[model samples]
Structure formats: C-alpha cells, structure tokens
Target: MSDASLNPTATDRWMLPEGIEEVLPPGAWQLESLRRRLLDVYQRWGYQLIVPPLAEFLDSLLTGVGHDLDLKTFKLTDQLSGKMMGIRADMTPQAARIDARQPGNGIRRYCYIGSTLLTRPKGVNGSRAPVQVGCELFGSDALAADAEVVCLMLHSLEACGVPATHLELGHMGVYRALLARTGISEAETVALFEALKRRSIPDVDHLSASLPENERELIRALPRLSGGLDVIGKARALLDHADLTAALDALEQVAQCVQKDFPDVDIHIDLGELRGYTYHTGLTFSAYRSGMGSALAHGGRYDGVGASFGRPRPATGFSLDLRALLPLIQAQATPPLAVLAPAEGGEALEAAIRELRRTRPVIRRMPGDALEDYSDSCDAMLTCKDGVWRPEPFSNRS
Candidate 1:
C-alpha cells in the first residue's frame, strides 16, 4: 500500500533495514549450537522450556511493564479483531502471562529462546532482532530465588565457554529508598535517575542542587559508587539510613555466594546504578566480560511482573543475545565433512547415502552440479565397487 512497496528499487531488494542482520552458513550454525547448549544448561537447572507467541494483544504484552519497554515495542492493528497487537520486544512479559494462567501457587521455572523485534536497538550498532535466551523463576520472593538465578547466569556462561570478567550488583530498593528520602517531585526524580545512569556529573549536580544537603550529597555520590566490594562499605557510611540495612545485606549475601562459585571473578557493588528492567523490584545485576563495552548478560529480581497479568508472582531472570556471544564463544563446533553422492543413483546408493547422512552429512550432487560444486563440503565420494556402495576419499581440484 506504500510507495516503496509498489515502486521498490534494486537497493531495497538486497538491503536489510539498519540493525537487522542475516546469519549465514557457519555463523548460523554456530548460533544454533550456542542456543542449544545454553538451553541444555537451563534444562539441567530445572527450567522447563517455553515458546511464547511472537505477537500478542498490546495491553496483554505491555501490562505493568514500564514506558521504556513500551517505547521499544512495535505496535500494529490486528486485522481479525481490529484490536491493537504488539510484536513482543522481550519475552519476560509473555512468560509472566503463561505463569499467571497456570493452575497452581507452586514455584515455576521457565526458559525461553526466540527472536524478538524492537523498534530501536538498545545500543549503538546493536541488533534490532536479537535471539533472546533466558530463564525466569516465578513464585518466590526469597533471596535464594534471586541468588539461584544469579548463580545460574554464571553457569550459563560457563556452559557456553564464555569467561565472565566480573559481575556488578545493585538493588532497585536503594534507588527507591534514595528517591523516598530525596522528597523531589516525580518529574525531578525521573530527570535525576536519567542523569545518574548516564554518569553526567554536571547534569546530576545541577538537577539535585535544589535538594536538601544530605539527600543531595547522597545523590551526587552515585556516579562514584561503582567498583569493588568496598563500594558497599562506602554506601553504608554515606547511605546509612535505617531502611537500607536489609537491601545492603542482601547484596553482600548474593555477592558472597557468587564469589564462592567464581572466586576469580571481580565482584563490584554499586548502590547507585539503576541498570535493569523498570519492573525490577529488588536486586539488579549485570555481568561483564573482557573486551565488551556493555554487560554480557543482565537480570535481577522483578517480583511483581506477573501481577500485571492478574497473578502476583515473584520473578527473577536474565536474558542475553545468543548471536552476540558467537564471537566470544571459546570453541566452535567443528563443521562436519560430507560424502558426495552422484546425481544418478540406484536404490542401494540411496540407502547408502541415507545411512551416511544418519551419522554425518551426505551431499547429493544435483543435476549438472559438477564435482567442483561439492568441493567445499565433501571430503569423500560415494561409489559402487563390485556390488557394495562405499565412501572413498576423494579430492576435487579447484
């Protein structure tokens, strides 16, 4: 119905929209291998697999999720019902809906791996459609639930052979508590949060200058709050409000357990970082690897995301782009060699090719496809000697 669709140019035929990508051959295979490997790890940790629909009613998809996600979601009208529909930007909300529909109050662990579309990429040069892989644990608010997901996130990286350099821990409670203490207007609090996350010292100072001295000092301290376990100690001295005790203790406990599992990993605590889903209610974290500019994987305690679906379940989970880790995966799956079978083959030859394919690939040369066509994939050739169909080593000169 649009001009571009009717009068498409040659460039439009071949060019993908910015941030969209196509993974070809070896790269696609590698992505698949990593996806399966990570899913296996989740299964071993007791997470059941789930496949949420790619699109859903807009309200159902975005319920209780904040405006940040809402802005990233792509919305369109459904032809059948003429109601608003959205392509899911993140599967967490869909997983929450599934949990809400389930019949019990017992804890549930769900894992999902699927491609999600976003209106804009999260970071510069990031994918618009990322293959998101994650596990969400619903029905428990215990710190143990949060820690389990944290430890599981580490094991997931280990399973995929990605060596994480460090993990940063923060609590949504700290920010919420700080906000309560600041007594700033909602508009001002939103502006301050934006400035703090960007670490814009001048903007942060200017924004909070109107606040009381005690609260302003605490607000200004956030940008400098990153790094090492000593951050917690500094936070306690600076943010020594009575309400922060339990939140800080939870941070220490989670950090201590992570240190036991991954002793070499640097554990940094930041009370000021608000780097997580807006729905996150308590602890939030991000894990980093060497050479990556942003967090490799991140998740936190978002206890009430399910409540928007009419089920007030506690939830925690983490998701990372499967293809994003392709380059960083320590080992690559060895591409299997194939046996080339001639285009003209008898039933016996067909049977032999099928059997060979059962174990490894067997490339059947199509009509007019010369030996040169099979050179890339085949290291051997299928031939009939006397009465037996056998594979013999063959080298096609290029």
Candidate 2:
C-alpha cells in the first residue's frame, strides 16, 4: 500500500517511521545503573566526564575523520540559519574538537555517555538508535598510557559483571604494512583490505596472484595470522618488509606488557584484525565474550586524530554500547517498587510516603478497579487503614 493511502492524514498518530522508538514502561533504571557504574570507573581513573552538544556544523563534525565516517553522518540544513548541520554519529571527533578549542597545558581525560542516531539498512533488526558510553585520554602517547586504557577497559567489564571476557589485540601498523608490501594498485589494495576484513581467504588469494612473488606469499598468509599469543611470533617471522617488522615489534611489546601485568587475562593477537576509526595509529584492541558476535568494547591509539582537530595531542580510549551488553550480561531481575495509594484527605499519609521513598523506588498509583489485580504489579501495596500505614504483599509472574 502507498504510504499516503495508508495514512491519509499524514499526521496520523499511529503511523511512525522506522529507526525511531519511544521509551515506555519506564525501565531505564538498569541502563542508568550501568552508566553510573562505568562513569564511576572513569572517575576513579581521573577521567572527568563531559557531554558534547548533539548537533554541530557538518564540516566541523567531519573535519578530522576520513571519508568513511563522513559518509555515514546524518546531515540536514537548519531552517532558521540555513546552515548545514549534522547529528553526531560518533563522539570521539567531537571530544577532539573540544580539546582543540580549549587547549590545555598538560594531559586531559574525558568521558561521555550519550545516545547517537544512525540509519540501519533494511535487513538489520533491533533499534538503530544506540547508546554510546566511552572515555578519551589526550596528550599522552607513552606505550604505558595505551596499556592503562586497556587495563581500565578490562576492569570496567569486570565491574559490570561480565565473565570470561578476552582482549583481542592487533596493530593497524602491522596490517597496513602487510598490505603495502603486496605492491598492488591503490584500488586493489582497498579490495584486498576489505577481503581481509571479511576473512575471505579465497578472494585474497585470487587478488594476490597478480602481485610480486614475495608479496603473494604475504597475502596468502593473512588468514593464518590470527590466533592466541602465538600469532605474534608468527607475524614477526612472516613479515619481512621493514615497516611490517617495526609494526610487529610494537605489537609484541604490547603483548609482553599485557602479559606481565594481566597474566590471567586471555590475550590473543590477530595481525590481520584491523578495525577502528581513522585516528587509530598504533596498538588497537577489543574485548569479547563467547556468546556475543561483536566486541563488547574496542579502542586503540589515535595519536594523529587530535592533531587533525588542531590539537596535537596523542589520545586513546574505548567505548561500549550499553544496549549491546544487555543481552550478554546476566540480568538480575529487580524487585518491583511498592505503589502507595493516597488516603482520602489525610495529610499524615503523604508524609509517610515521602519518608518511604528515601530507601526505595516507589510507584504512586494502583491501576484498575480491582485492588487485588494491581497488587501483583508492585513489591508491596501501602494504604492507610484506620489511620495506620499497612504493607501488603504483591507478586507477578516470576
């Protein structure tokens, strides 16, 4: 059916577009709790929280980042000013802009928790609007600084009650060097890179066939370059080019540092895993659990990204989608809050309700004609019987 025919008034209340949602039933307590816990972690680590404006000039938003991110940003012209504005699809660039505007003498740590809107293609299920919670550390490129961010991320996951999470480490330097060694045209290099991302070995093999003998060997070996810590040693041996060797050394150093401090943390090296924003310069890593198909958290070194924003500070940080974590983490069902029924013309009863709220989350009204029916919806029902407050038990399908 035509959209106009389905909603003749176009203003029909029931007709709404996809990719938008209403938060009803008021169960944001869990989400808020998660955010608070994460922010607490950031705070203890000396990262001050900041909330960047949701809208900015499209040019400002896309200034530093590469074409890939620029294409995905949602753009629109402001009606009042007739200036192009874009909704922030990512927060890191905004944070960089903020740092540039307010140049500091020393290092700065910033954290943010907010919602971002993105348009998902038709086949994808679930909400397109995602909640992004992340932290960025600026003005430090010390390898130890990068390690600290990874450690904090691991601890944050642990604080959130995530279990058996492992950190998969990789260096963008290694991946790019390997690609450059292939001696392929710029177009072919991009295609080969995409194939590696998709883990399509056959396609990579086909593409590598036209390259020099040494380059072909490097391309064909891409698939076997991932596993646990052993991949680091393999990468060191497999890569012969100078740039590739240097990248391998950096990855190895990070592996050693992580092992020294976090012995129990499962550290896997995937020389082929290259996924991050354009700002990522050196070591990049992500956290994953067995059940989730995607990384629960990912971040890496982006020393050059800050410079693009006019602040020549080295920075690195990671952000996790709290919504993505909900399905993976074990959810503890919170007991229903008690609903108190107001007494008829009783001032004392209202005072008592206010006192009760100090210790517990409370809902105020009982729904429906039958009081017994509504009782099950709350943890307990409070009502004044003969000028005395009484508590009654409530339950629902457990």
In order of appearance, the predictions have TM-scores of 0.91, 0.87
Q: Can you write out model 2's per-residue Cα lDDT over 218-325, one digit (the tens) per residue?
A: 778866788887787787677777888777777777777777767877888887776762457788989888766677888988876766666677888888777666
lDDT of 1: 0.86
Error of 2 at 360 (Å): 0.5
The global Cα lDDT (0 to 1) of model 2 is 0.74
lDDT of 1 by residue, 263-344 (tens): 9988988776887626788999888987778888899988877777778988899988887887675254556678888887
Misplaced by over 4 Å in model 2 are: 1-12, 121-123, 181-183, 240-246, 256-264, 277-279, 328-330, 339-348, 366-369, 383-392, 395-398
How far off is residue 172 in model 2, in Å?
0.5
Model 1 clash tally, residue pairs: 0
The TM-score that candidate 2 achieves is: 0.87
